[model samples]
Target: MALPVLVLAVRWVMMIMGSDPRAVGLSAEPIDYTINYLGLWAIRFLILSLAITPLRTWARWSWLAPLRRPLGLWAFACALLHLSVYFLLDQLGSFSLLWESVAKHPFILLGMAAFTLLLPLALTSTRGAIRRIGARRWQALHRLVYLAAIFTAIHFILRVKGFQPEPWIYAGVAAVLLLVRALPTAWVRRA
Candidate 1:
């Protein structure tokens, strides 16, 4: 699905590098723009994955149920790429540089933490792991997705700074999706 996006990105980069006469801004390569685009897409996928359960239950679309895991895995893939670009290309794979980034940039630090948590979820998403651990336990472990979403929102908000509308929009959407699951159970228990 993302292959076309990658191809378009490559073409855009080539155009930006001024190899093509018809290209615009054909001089400066906007690395930051590319990274931000990937990050936002990953975040959007995460949001969509989070929405699956609610959509299934409320809309009674059982077909939507199967997409959640794959969507999450895709989110993890994009996140890995996003972090790789930042850490390898942006920070040059230097431990000292990454440490400095962690110390100096709260947003980057938050993003790193979020990505770290996601690694285990991505690894153990297999049917074998789920069966070995038992479904109930696996479900409990996967609840880490909520925390991951929270951390991701923090990363996004920190990245944008100063109440940017887009981060807030994503945060709002995530909050609603999470609340859809939480509110019903809380209500049932209270009642």
Candidate 2:
């Protein structure tokens, strides 16, 4: 599952390790590509993570239920890597540059806000944490993932110019996932 991200990291490192990095093709284009790739994977895993409840409740796929935690964790990991690549490689590890980006591009702030929301959820995802926080409270708190996904959708939309179907499709998927989760489970059950 993590091997693709590992491979991407290795390729990114290899491309940027030398002084003549541009000669080796370490340029804005590849950085943008990598950033896009990371963001896509983050969104993908996030949707998958959010889908488990609906699947378990409506489809009664108890066997697939255990995957929820791991999927959410991977979503967080990919999102973190997405932020890291932007902050580290794209901005050259400059906080000022990042802030400047936030000022210049609203999407950066949206992305950061999404990440901020995910932090607590990631921190308290464990069984022990749930025990400490109480399952009801933990479940309530984890619902923040919906807000995070919304912010991510806006960020993605702003990142692109004019109109594109891709970001909107992801946003629509996020919306449908939320809708399904909100539905009365007793009203609809399929075998």
Candidate 3:
């Protein structure tokens, strides 16, 4: 948590300081880099949160269960930041431009779809909300994360102009995580 926050802060500071010799590549297009950085962290955190269940099941480490909530929240936070950068910096708070981008870019639409799905999960992350929803219902609702992850990966892959290994790698990671979740408990245990 602290690490992510610290990295975000440093990135923000570097973006502001633009033209620093050390920040060459990032300084050239700070907003774009910041957006990408935030999105990457969001995906990484989402994957980490999803991994908690499998880790707990395989390692028998119950303590890891408590971490799922925070990781999920962090993913949402990073996603929010990513959207903010796009809206505020890239789109200049123009709804017309935003709508145009959404219409013109399939990746933007996919990213928006992923964020929409994440909203409910983030809102229901609280213990009180979980209790109100009932455990079974809450679990079912949270299963939307798989769809969100898929959308996110597609959004990422489609955004790049040329073939890049980074986006593909993230998509691959998402695929593996989803596969792990889809596997039967007995099958997982036998492995």
Candidate 4:
């Protein structure tokens, strides 16, 4: 809470100073750079939240399980900021232009798709919703996160306009995460 608030304040100061956050080794946009990083934090923590299930089940860390929902909500909150920045600042309130960019820019499209998927998952993260849907159905709904990850990678990759190490790192992490669930089912013997 305090961290994000402080970061936002600093971002405003930097933007007012007319400094490029990325040029200063901060972020791409000095004004909204902090929000961008917050978005990244959201995505990273979302991934981390998903891993908690596997960690608890496989590694037997029951304590980590409790953190999932809160982290997921935090991720969602940050995602909202990310999208807000994209629309309000990046797109400059041009829905038409935003749609145009989605059609023309593969990265924008992929990222938009990823965020779209995340929207539903976040909405259903409540305890009442979980109880109403039950575990199996809820689990199925949340599985969209994996697809969201792929889209996110494509988003990052295309945004770079060429090969970049950072996107590859994200891709690799998402791959390992998906594989964890996949390898088990693949190894199951039909008796």
Highest lDDT among the candidates is held by which one?
3
lDDT of 1 by residue, 5-104 (tens): 4754676777656565235332344557557766887788899999988776766677998899888988898898888778777899898999998889
Each model's lDDT:
0.81, 0.85, 0.87, 0.74
Best-fitting candidate, measured by TM-score?
A: 3
TM-score of 3: 0.90
Candidate 2 deviates by what RMSD?
2.9
Candidate 3 lDDT, 1-191, residue by residue in tens: 74875776776676567646246445566777779888989999988888899888776788999899999999999999999889999999999999998899888999998999999999998889989999999999999999999999999898788888998998898898788877898888778
lDDT of 4: 0.74
Of candidates 4 and 3, the better by lDDT: 3
Q: Least lDDT summed over 10 consecutive residues: which range in candidate 3?
A: 19-28
Residue 151 miss distance in model 1 (angstroms): 1.1
lDDT of 2 by residue, 1-191 (tens): 58758867676787767434344444556778778888888888888888888888888888888888888888889899899989999899999999998888778999998998999999998899999999999989998999999999888888889878999999999899999877788876842
Off by over 4 Å in 4: 1-6, 13-28, 185-191
Q: RMSD in Å for candidate 4, one decimal? A: 3.9
Better of 2 and 4 by lDDT: 2
Question: Of 2 and 3, which scores higher on lDDT?
Answer: 3
Residues 90-148, candidate 4, lDDT per residue (tens digit)? 78889998999889988788878988998999999888999999989999999898888
| Best-first order by lDDT | 3, 2, 1, 4
